[model samples]
Target: MGTWIKETDKAIYLMDGAYYLQKIDKTAHTGQVEGETFFRTGQLKTWLNSKEPPGFFLVSVGTGVSEPQPLPPPPAPPLSQGITITKSPSQVKIYQPYQVAGTASTSLVGKTVELYIDNSSSPAAKTTINDNQQWLVQSVFIAVPKPQVRNLKVVAGDASDVATLTLTPYIEDHPGGTKLNLGGSVGSGGSNRASDVRKVQERLIALGYTFANKNYETFVQTIRLFQSIISGRTAVRGVDGRIDVNGRTQRFLEAANAPQWMLMPSRGVGFYNLEVIDQPWDKHDYGIDWMSNVIKAAGIHYELAYRKNREGIAPIAVNDVSLPQGGDTIDHAGHETGNAGDLALPRLDGDFGGITWSDRRYDRPATKAVLEALRAQPWVNKSTLYFNDPVLINQRLCSRAAGHDNHIHFEVMVPPTP
Candidate 1:
């Protein structure tokens, strides 16, 4: 059979039934080209290209002519219009089970959808889209350590949308009376007189409710949260998100914000107790919870940080915190509230007894370490230390005092609200 190149109006052609035949390019017209065969139809069109060849074609093996067809072009990629947040609550309880639902593009089906709070790179929760192009994150919790507004962002591929939400603490508001009074109603559906609303708003701010400015939307939700958590009966009060004059909500808010004290438990986690020395009736361990937490944390830090092996070091000894009722004491000039306390300095022999700084048993390094740890607590008010250690005083750790020669005296202030 004679072999030659064949051309058609719409395309060029080559045909052979021998599957093992090496591909013959247009560059070799006179001699047999030596290479792999183009027996497979997938690579046939590429082999039949006319651009880089010596211009030769092959003849058909039999009477019927065979023509190679090009494969159809691939379909275009789908365009993304972005994801959307469809169902989300305006107010959600902090740390409680919450549901968020949204819709994404069909292209994002089976792709991961992430829910973020504010600008956080880490996702608060995630889920995959269904065949219907919708996603739902079920029973995922949103954290709100303090009262504030949050922006929830749902993202799929390069598309995202944001929804605003307010978060309220899950704690119940116990019954308490507040001396604070309002001239008129100060919440949703209330008089909302600028002065009355301002007073209530400022009080809420002091109690850790946060808002950018005075607006009814935020105000109503905060009030509703406050009302919902107020346990116990104060007559016929309801959770209406409104604070009428002399209402139970107003009373609860006042009582919640009152100056409360907590008595340090006897022999607790990080620190141990050393009860009243002589005046048992006057000396006590009653102090506010925040200050007590600072002391306890300091004790933990001192034991863990000062020595590599906490096995040998005795825990910090607490002499006094405040009276059971928080009043004047004959031994101290200023231990009225839980604001101040006396801690026996660390001893050379790791004893819990008191020792003056001048005593040979005084462990200056250990003492300084504990004091430094105490000062490092975030809630500590950085009050002046009342110990007579000249070296420590020079190191800015303590100040010399007239009567504070036996132990260290320090005070703490209440932490400010956000």
Candidate 2:
């Protein structure tokens, strides 16, 4: 057929019994339009039917066909001749470099491939397809606080493909074999090898520790502070302010930036679990934040029911554990972060019915037991229970709060930031 083309808002160039549609990609071009080919006729028809612009009608070129007609379905499967991803890391750590590899058609060889991450306008990476029709984007890194899924899209000209990968917090690994050992100790009264000291300083920075300088005294004090907060050695004698090769301090630092988990409903356990409960006052139950430690502590706390001979107790209920993005919810004062949540008070007869701490139906003993278990958790801030039970407060289990008579508001310890 002679020079067959269809025109509407977007121009469709039809040649050799194939249709190519051109659309504007603002990022792909300064003032030019890019043509995208639809492999199936149905897809083109759907687009044409749905996206017909106002005051626009199709203008057919030549006498090949006056109007677009539905063609018969192909007998064979479509050929493997498009851009496809062959390699991508399922889980990637934040701030760590990774690579994504894929193959394109031989016709796309020597062309550029643009990688777009999440909803960002700019491409995270770009590379040219090689002679073998293979493309690799190297040294791709993502920076985020907690664990989350990241959407990745690669576009080579008009051909595009999408992928998803888990973007986790950066957790450094312990080097294996001889690499495990540092050159020397990295602190006061130690050899303080330059390389070893640099390594320690870098890890501390990643863990959100900041120091004025790398002076010997400042480094030592920073090490001691890290020991007190992160390494769990608060005592004067316990904190040596030194990191020996393959020592406990080194191990803690290496594992400091591990991935966090979202608070989820328990799987196998019975009533002892802290399951997600509805908040009567809130519009939506936003229990989607990073509170895995709190959930785990609830399980550990309620497991004591068997030991206390209170196995028939109702499952502990939790509410309003922050939004997925960790911001203030409606009608709340302090749940702006991910690590805090509200726990329903235990009532008489082990039911989930509402009861204030002052009410006679309030099961003080059971609530007290839960408080003790929560306090025992390593991640829990021991002195910060925001429930206003007089008896428990007098007993020093929890402190008094003005509006916390109905529920207990607790916070889990989060990593320090500079």
Best by TM-score: 1
What is the alpha-carbon lDDT for the whole of candidate 1?
0.59
Q: lDDT of each model, Cα atoms only?
A: 0.59, 0.56
Clash totals in order? 4, 0
- How large is the C-alpha RMSD of every model relative to the true structure? 18.5, 20.9
Report the lDDT tens digits of candidate 1 across residue range 1-418.
3222444332334433222123333322344675323323444556545354324554544436444443344698764666777777665543233556777777788887777776789877666666677765533232345436666677776545443444333422423333566888877788888888777776666654454134677677667644543421111124687898987678756754323346664565446667644336545767654456566666655554455355556566777876654445666766655667788777788775567889998888877876776665544445556788899989988788887778888776432221
Error of 2 at 91 (Å): 24
